[model samples]
Target: MANSTTLSTGKTFAWGGGKSPFSVSYGKLMMWIFLLSDAFTFSSLLIAYGFIRYSYQAPIANTIIKPLQHVGENFVEEMKKAGLFVQDHWPAPELVFNHFPFIHGMHLPLFFVSLMTFILIFSSVTMVLAVEAGHRMKKDEVANYMLLTIIGGAAFLGCQAWEWATFIHEGARLDYNPFGPRSFAALFFIVTGFHGFHVFSGVVLNVIIYLNVLAGTYEDRGHYEMVEKVGLYWHFVDLVWVFVFTFFYLI
Candidate 1:
């Protein structure tokens, strides 16, 4: 095995000066490092959230109230009638997210968020296609797939904004919440909101890459590494959402 100094500097001049040991580009390696660090941050936040939630549940273990039962045309109103808002009992994720666009007084639990998740996952697929196109030197295909990916990302962000609005309108804030515990709303905003910011940033990055593709920047360089790089970030955004959905919604 090579020594640390030799491994760090690489075997040749072309491989020296911040080259990766695992044969990745400097930029890509840096992205991996940054993502690894970010994973730790998210893991810490999630662990803290779990600890806080567990502690909060301990005191109310015996007194834990069942979720309000609802049916018929006015479920939201029914919930309101029964004082079934996100208070006293742990709010059911389905009950909380049972909202749809422009159709007031409907109980569409998880429908919208499920759609959003589908879009995000599909965007990851489009990103993979874009990267494949880049490899094949199919500039037009790369551009098309990248555009689709961007549209998917933008739609997801818009849906997230709508979700945030609904959450706020239904009473959620950093310090105050209708939820059983204050930390429910706080962690929701901090964890998922931070994740939304990442989505927004990824959308901007995709837009930049799309424009560069249009301008044939990669053609000039004889490579579409930028698309691949941004794709990494985009896929990471999508992957994080899976966890958020599990933690915040399903679990």
Candidate 2:
């Protein structure tokens, strides 16, 4: 706590100054490098997804999330006894997922993804505010916004879990979906599901930081710059989602 005040005095120091390797610390630099590498990994995944989608689009006659076809009531009971859902008569892709509220047409559950995107974006904005608060050394302000960001992350994860259930539940199956390039459903599930994992990890990391920050760890250590470093990661997670939204939902 004493060091914090001394370090904060006009950034010019005498006896009570903070010193570390590389004019800062090796840990912070490594974090930055790791983040940069993660950036590339995410970029490659999205680009590969786009390439595969477009390359196979020509051969794929239909690409849509359709409803399950075949038997009506007692469908699951009969099929599960046989260890497979009723797959006798399948509906066309156009007919399955095309039902919109009062609008007779196919519409994917992309709206849910869009909603999740907004949630992440809102969280990122709050994270930015948290970083700003840290810069000003308003520890309480930073803590409040960081908590908002954490809650937002949890909400996003909840939405993602609900969406995954909607996707994997047998009731929502598209007959053609269990297959290959013919089924974008699987790809959608895989890609977005993976992103959700990243978000989940980010939330956990931020929570740990929040705990440490609350324990006077940063203040006692003489700087809250760790908050800013973690914020960089928080922002990166949101940025990756921008590509996810465009590639998975929009395209």
Cα lDDT of model 2 by residue, 57-83, tens digit: 232223322343333334334433543
lDDT of 2: 0.66
TM-score of each: 0.83, 0.67
lDDT by residue (183-207, candidate 1, tens digit) is: 8889989998889899999999999
The CA lDDT of each predicted structure is: 0.80, 0.66
Instruction: Count the clashes in each prediction.
Output: 1, 3
Location of the lowest summed lDDT over 10 successive residues in candidate 1: 58-67
Q: Candidate 1: which pairs clash?
A: 86-178
Measured by TM-score, how close is model 2 to the native structure?
A: 0.67
RMSD of each: 5.1, 9.1
Tell me how many residue pairs clash in candidate 1. Answer: 1
